[model samples]
Target: MNREEINKLFGVTDEQLDHMAAEYESGKWEGGVGPIVPGRPRIYDEELETISFRLPKSRVNAIDARAKRNGETRSQFLRQAVDDALLANA
Candidate 1:
């Protein structure tokens, strides 16, 4: 859809639409005209670490169900749980 369509659909102000159009004309805007991919936000830093472990099938199933109910993936739910646990301990 075009900018005017998007503006009408999202109720964006005319001024905002004009600014976006100007940015597009100036080649300063680089966003794609597609649905955003969902998941964890990307973090490009050395401080981030990756760890993997295996869980029992029953536990994994339970986690998947809970995560789905909460509108999150298993990884997102686990990450938030870990952060909360650390804060609680602290």
Candidate 2:
């Protein structure tokens, strides 16, 4: 649907419709289009893969404490550590 159609349908001004259209085109519609509906597919990039590993309670606490000391989350600390290790090994 075009901007004019959207403005007419939603009883909004032409400028508002143009702004909405621009936002949609830029993929900034986080709450989804128009009214909420069930089974609407969410589109996002799949560039990063999620991995989970379990460590001992002590190790987990240590990691969390170290991360807090460095003013970073455990995940961020692990990511930085991995990047540093990889670069050092290379």
lDDT of each: 0.83, 0.79
What is candidate 2's lDDT per residue for 54-82, written digit by digit as tens? 88999999999999999999988988888
Backbone-clash count (model 1): 0
lDDT of 1 by residue, 1-90 (tens): 997798799999799877988877676765676434456557544567889999999999999999999999988899998999999999
Query: Per-prediction TM-score, please?
Result: 0.55, 0.48
User: TM-score of model 1 relative to the true fold?
Assistant: 0.55
Please give the lDDT score at residue 65 for candidate 1: 98
Q: Candidate 1: misplaced stretches above 4 Å?
A: 1-27, 30-40, 43-46
Off by over 4 Å in 2: 1-46
Query: What lDDT does model 1 reach?
Result: 0.83
Q: What is the lDDT of residue 79 in candidate 1?
A: 90
